[model samples]
Target chain A: MTYDWTLWIVFILIGLATTLPRGSFIILGERASLPEGLQKALRYAPAAALAAIVVPDVVLVGGVVEVLNPKLAAAFAAVLATQVSRNPWLPFIVGMGVLLGLRHFL
Target chain B: MSPSFREGAREGFRVFLPLSVGLIPWALVTGMTMGGVGFTPLQAMGMNVIVFAGTAQLGTLPLIAAGSPVWLIVVTAFVLNLRFIIFSAALARGFHGVPRAERWLAGHLLTDGVFATCLEKMLSHEDPRWRLGYYLAPSLWSWLLWQVFAFCGVMAAGSIPKSWSLEFMATIALIVLLVPMARLRPMLLAALTGGTLAVLLRGMPLRLGVIVAIIGGIAAGFAAERWQGAAR
Candidate 1:
């Protein structure tokens, strides 16, 4: 397919928008503090945002909501690993292994 | 310089190692999605090099597939990535003492996972360079893995089965990573609020509901923290 300049432009703009905030703050360097309330809120934002994104995706399959999907099961396994070991790598590897194995069986 | 250039480079490599595993699947999925959407391997690789953000790239792929207006796709992607504004602000505070050049370079490497990991490390270690080390180590790994795995996906695009449910794997990976971080009540509240709001608002057009869910979650978290502080 031929290149679309518009798509390229959009991609660049999106990239810019994404990077700007991170860069701007670093470049600006301590001119201000995040409002205390917002700072506190920021702490939770990632976990919340990530959970919001991940939960539904893992639970829903083929228009049916089932948390028992292999993906969710693997995720639960990973969570358990994380809780027990607190080792980031172990849980990920174990989860991936479980998912890969289940994928084969299913 | 807050961290010697050598130190920064070392930090970056260290950050890159552990994160490579998690990023591999994500990057592979992204490349596969891009290729499935009909992007050439070159285009997909270029996107990885330049855009570098996973969700925004994934978000824009559908628009490209649908032959949507380029400007609209770009705008939507920009909107989707607005979260970095908060991340940037937080990081700016932490790296305030660093020189402009170093700060700018670090900013280029800033990412959600990196920022979160770095912030947590900084909370425990007072030395800014140590925090930089912690942040750069995983982040560098993630970046390299994303590029390599994405390239593999793009090259083997047709061979990769759609049934693999790689996206599902990515979601599971994120959930696994996030569970360890949700240690506080405010954090828990935010997660619950965001998840509920996202489901409630899932039907909204243009994925605006996701944004709303994010804002709601953040607000709820802030409120919870404030209330707890007041109680204390």
Candidate 2:
């Protein structure tokens, strides 16, 4: 329960985090001109950040990097599944299936 | 609620519904993963509804779990959502001379999908009223789906099996989002270099490797873009 306050504070701060940037232009669109270099960096940051997050989750098991892991195999399988289907859920479905199947068998 | 605004809003909802439907899986997964983080279901709901950012909300969870400094959590979320700056700027520029209220509201509602949809539609023929209505209408529809689905997930979270590791679904979803971007050379470089560095630096305390990876990835991508430009 002690963490409740912290969580609440986070909610408010996050709300600002989202609203502020999104509204940055509306409030100052006429005067605000993001640098061309900044824009390019922003374009690539999300993919990179997502990659960072996803890499550790799948490649590392309990902190140490493990070669033989269900998550790792599932990730590769997910890439293949996505290539084959236009279905939005195909990657998740195939990846999870592989993960569970491998976990059960191995 | 002028006739023009109402008509535009109707069209907007029709246009954005298909994309909003795609958000369902992501919304539910976010809710479930949030619940699995040991927060109460109410807290989970609050995070989704109040923050109203899927990526930032999910990205900040590790910091919250680790009991990282409050400032760090806020800064991380802000960095994670930096794309909104580009999105909002482009969106706002197109709405030149729109009413102040509508402009502000549109900015608040400027989501990734909404920004893209708004840009694709030629709303300039219509007045600011219609444009504002069009933006608000679809956003309302999307927000409703986000809340309803996320709420359902949080409620059902208790009965969900823990051993299944449903939280991993968030990672898988992110992977799905990332894979298509790999087709772009600069993006591929960023992801590969960033992801590898993250693994190498995973030992960073308070999960600070994420921030480092993001910066490194952006630098690599910038360098790649400049290199490609020079080569051409």
DockQ of each: 0.42, 0.65
Q: Can you write out model 2's per-residue Cα lDDT over B1-232, one digit (the tens) per residue?
A: 6898898889889899888888887788778777766668889888887888888877777657667777777877787788999887776656666677766666666777887887756336447666766788988787788888888777776677777766676677777778888899999999998899889987787667777887899899989999999999
TM-score of chain A of each: 0.70, 0.86
Chain B TM-scores of the candidates: 0.64, 0.89
lDDT of 1 by residue, B117-227 (tens): 567544565566755666666666777878899898787775756655443444544565567567788888887788777677766777666667877887888888889
Query: C-alpha displacement of B126 in model 2, angstroms?
Result: 5.1
Deviating ranges (above 4 Å) for candidate 1 = A1-10, A30-33, A61-71, A84-106, B1-40, B54-103, B111-146, B149-159
Clashing pairs in 1: B14-B137, B15-B136, B15-B137, B15-B138, B16-B137, B16-B140, B16-B141
Question: Candidate 2 DockQ category?
Answer: medium
**Number of the top-ranking candidate, with lDDT as the measure:** 2
Q: Give each candidate's fraction of reference contacts reproduced.
A: 0.64, 0.74
Interface RMSD of each: 4.3, 2.2
Prediction 2: B-chain TM-score: 0.89
- lDDT per residue for candidate 2 within A13-38, as digits (tens), equals 98898878888876675777888878
**CA displacement after TM-score superposition, residue B137 of candidate 2 (Å):** 1.0
Model 2 chain B weakest lDDT span, ten residues long: B120-129
